[model samples]
Target: MIESPDGERTEHCGFIQKRGTNNIAELTAAIESLRRIPEGAEVILCSDSQYTLKGLGEWLPGWIRKGWKTASGSPVLNQEHWKLLHQEYLTRKVRLEWVRGHNGHPENETADQLANRGLTLG
Candidate 1:
């Protein structure tokens, strides 16, 4: 889902692959949002998934250092999506914000519903 400064909101839903995870969905959302938002502008990405936020913020440097491997010597799950999200992060001025889900936040609730709707589309 993307929201404009003028209070316009848009939601997009589709499968990233035959198989997907929540992290992939979150990363895809960030990447797609970056594509939608104008360049050189400040953006805040609100997400309920700590996996996505930590993967981009606290874990990226180490992942790059380890050649995309986790601390346990395992390859990072959703490495491709992480790389894409990282690239967008480099190209855009984005701040990842962790929001509590189902906490009465209007946009968050709407996004959750849209995500559920996407699942039913299949």
Candidate 2:
């Protein structure tokens, strides 16, 4: 998570489940981070995954109305994480920022390391 002055903080958390890919992992992390934030705080989510950024930022509402199904009528991946994010977003202001992976931004790098370590330990 990235914390700034003025009581602002950015959180990014995820998990690598047995069948989960990196996209799912990143989404999971982002959702986890969102859950820990206090109500009414402004949060900026930085992620390298465009799928995540676009999915949550743009496509989520329609998907939710469709019961988390995709255009092809397939169930959406990572529904639990998506649901959690959706719920938390209802109570806060969240902005998703896309960052290039491995580009050496401090918080992104740190979050990446923590995510990888979480994978190993899990």
Candidate 3:
């Protein structure tokens, strides 16, 4: 979803791939959300996937430092997405917020439904 500083908002969902993981969906959503908003815009992104959140927020620096390899000597699973997300994050004012899913948070629930509906399109 994209929201203007003035409070105008938009929501979007789409398939990242025919075979997908939760992390991919989460990252795809976030990347698309960032792309939709204006450059240098201040925006808050919310997601339930800890993999996506921590991967980009907490673990990104080490991954980049290690040339995108994991601590266990494996390559990061979604290097391209991570790089794109990190690039946007560095170039834009994006604040990522974590939200617990299926806990009856109205917006979260709605987003879940939207994501589920997107599966039918694949």
Candidate 4:
């Protein structure tokens, strides 16, 4: 879910792939949100998954430095998505925030609802 500074809120969702993990879903959400937000805008991209936030905040740089490989020389799990997200991430001023999931965060609840809706969509 993307919320505007004027209190406007929007939900984004879709079938990412045949199968995916929560981390992938989080990355997808961040990617989609970053794409939708205008360039040079202030962004607070929040997620419940540490894997996604950590990848963006910490692991992404190392992965890039290591040529998209992990510290152990294995390929990063979601390189394609990470690449896109990283591209968008660099174009804006974004504050990555980690929110506790299912703890009554309105945006998180909306995101959950949107995700559930995706399960029923074509």
The prediction achieving the highest lDDT against the true structure is 4
RMSD of each: 1.6, 2.8, 1.4, 1.2
Q: Pick the winner on TM-score between candidates 1 and 4.
A: 4
TM-score to true structure, per model? 0.89, 0.81, 0.90, 0.93
TM-score (C-alpha) between model 1 and the true structure: 0.89
Q: What digit string (tens of lDDT, one per residue) describes model 4 on residues 1-122?
A: 78899999877788766588777887888888899999999999888889888988999999999999999999999899899999999999989889999999988888899988876775
Note the clash tally of each candidate: 0, 2, 0, 0
Superposed by TM-score, candidate 1 places the C-alpha of residue 21 at a distance from the truth, in angstroms, of: 1.8
- The TM-score of candidate 4 is 0.93
- lDDT ranking from best to worst? 4, 1, 3, 2
lDDT of 2 at 11: 47
lDDT by residue for model 2 over 2-67, one digit each (tens)?
576575755444446478877677777777777777878888877888888898789898898888
In candidate 1, which residue ranges exceed 4 Å CA deviation? none
Best candidate (score: TM-score):
4
Q: Candidate 3 overall Cα lDDT vs. reference? A: 0.81
Give candidate 2's TM-score. 0.81
Candidate 3 regions exceeding 4 Å error are: none
